[model samples]
Target: MDKNKFIKDNFGISDKTLKLVSEAEESIKEQFKHIENICEINQLRVMKAFADNRVSDSHFVATTGYGYDDLGRDTLDRVYADIMGAEDALVRHNFISGTHTISTALFAVLRPNDILVSITGKPYDTLEEVIGIQGEAGNGSLKDFGVKYVQIDLKHDGTPDLEQIKFTLTHMNVKAITIQRSKGYGWRPTYSAKDIGALIEFVKEISPETICIVDNCYGEFVETEEPTAYGADLIAGSLIKNPGGGLAPTGGYIAGKQKYVELCAYRLTSVGIGKEAGASLGFNRQMYQGLFMAPHVVSQALKAAVLCSAVFEKLGFEVDPKPNEIRHDIIQSIKFGDPDKVTAFCQGIQKGAPVDSFVTPEPWDMPGYSSQVIMAAGAFVQGASIELSADAPIKPPYIAYMQGGLTYESAKLGIMVAADKMLRKE
Candidate 1:
């Protein structure tokens, strides 16, 4: 069957939703132009130099540290620092996952009894076990080290509660404050780098001495500026999510002041050794290329999100495409209000996956989450692949959270397919 007819038969999408999709695509194109301009003006030279050097080949030699002088690694460390606009940056292909990076950073900064306040409620589901909420099913994390955990409430509007944040800082013995920029478990309200900066300012004013850390995964390259621009003491992130650009096989990054980076590096590699001596098996040259193309690629994803939000809203589903003006990035969530429709929508998107395809939606126990019945159809071998992923929380009101597309074409196709499926069900 033809694509349109197939869609009409399986899912019903209205003409109004289609029109909104077209308009959103146009807006996305305009945003892409702006992104291109920014890259050309600011990062093109550095990117070009990296491309000319073919830095990926030197990965083994550069990271070997077997017989290399410490001076060379130290110099490269300074260079990375300059790239991140910080006193120091440590770029290693060693951090295996986002959790690893966060764990290392926490270990570096927090003492055995130091207090750690999560300014953004509970963290992603994967962290629940690590943070002491769940039992010792997984690797023992920060909670295992005897650190105190605190959570501050967010305001009704979804931003952090400034007054409560101040109360926590003043009353609690908070040694470190962590702000997760992206939403937990693949659901994020479009937030930009500048928004992160504002949050940093708020924290600094209340407790200047307390260490401020930001989980910058899924947020890199989405905005022109970065969290470090606003004074984040340490920013930890996954390369595969945004900066990796679908190029790196797997890895994470930590950027911040030299002292903190050194401390984290020690924690990542060991108390005495650093990542400089670790195996380079984790870093991929494709990741470097992906990072170069990320700004434009992410712009396309954002466009898709905006378009999808408009389409879902027109179709009678409550939608929040741009929750806040400060949030200016990708990620669109649509409330299906029906479990079956949410499943069908996910199926439709999976059919359009670039890498692989499958449909097995069911309820299973996910660590760190009280909610049950989570479903995901992702293209990547690991769940981090955002090429096309849409899942909904199984609660009273079900909403499918969707984001990530390699290109505007695929993202638009996925949205159209899912819309068609929903329409057919109706």
Candidate 2:
């Protein structure tokens, strides 16, 4: 189907909605110009630095010793720390997923029987099982270790209730507080790193000894500032998301104060063996390039989300598009009432994946979330990629939650193609 016909048939966007989408696209294009200019300036600096031999071209290999081991990975870690404005940073390819990174951080800080206060209610579906919440049938991380867990749900406005947070801190022997930067799944609203900073301050006031940790997975590089920038004790994230810049094959990072990084390093590699060994292979280069390209790629994803929202909202679907000055990025959700429409939309999206041509929805036991049906389309070699995921609630009034596109062009194409498919059915 042609683009216009496809849009008309599937999305049913009105003329007013098209006008708004057009305006948003133009605004994004203008923003991209600024991003290009910044990239050019940074690129020139990089080239000059390269010519001057200021940066090493040889890949840094992780060794097994403290100061003597993994000089390359260590140096990269320091560089990342400086970039993220944290006291220390540890990057490792050994972490297969974001959950691994968070688990490492938790293990480093929490002792047996220590309490983990979840400031962001429940975490992503995968993390629920690890934290010993929903999937207790098998031994999980927290359950195996005997760690206590507590959660404080965000209000409908997406703000943590300071009083509730204070109450939880006061009532529990909290060892650490985990706050997710963005809504992991579903169409719930969220706070920016800055907004989260306020909650962090509140938590600290209630429990001075409690360590503050942020699950900074999908949120990396979406904002000019990060949770660490606002006094978060530890911030952990995946290399495959915003920070990966569509470059990293696989990796994760933890950044915070020097002491936390040190402790996490010990937990990550076993206390006796530090990162000086060859734990971080093929990660430094991807991290370097990913960090360099992150802002641009994120901007593209933001554009696609905004455009999709405009189109979907016009078509009479309830959509949550981040406001002009909103903090969270790379998530756009549309509420489609019919399960069949949700399934068809997901299939259309999967057809656009870089790695796979077709995907289908399935029912599974997803920990942490109450949803039944799930669907995803990833652009990576393995199915581990979140470059795009579209799932719907299996209950009545199904709403398809769609997100991804490593590049802005691909994301835009995905939305347009999905819209086209919908229009044809209409």
Q: Best-fitting candidate, measured by lDDT?
A: 2
Candidate 1 lDDT at 411 equals: 75
Instruction: State the displacement of the C-alpha of residue 59, model 2, in Å, after optimal TM-score superposition.
Output: 3.4
lDDT string for model 1 (1-426, tens) is 666455445545456546556665555555456655754543554464355444544542333335234333344445445545567666555667777778778889988898988887667666666667666733666778888888875666777777888888888778898888777543335346677678778877878878888887667665556677778888887766666666656677788877888899788776666645554432434555565566666656665676677667766887766422233445567777787777787777776566555565565666546786555555553665445577666775677778777777877777877776677677
Structural similarity to truth (TM-score) of each candidate: 0.84, 0.84
TM-score of 2: 0.84
lDDT tens digits by residue: candidate 2, 121-217: 7787778777888765557478678898888887777667677888878888899999887776655775678877887888887788889999887
Q: What are the runs in model 1 whose C-alpha is more than 4 Å off?
A: 1-80, 136-139, 185-191, 282-284, 323-329, 358-360, 378-381
Each prediction's whole-model lDDT (CA): 0.66, 0.70
At residue 49, candidate 1 shows an lDDT of: 38
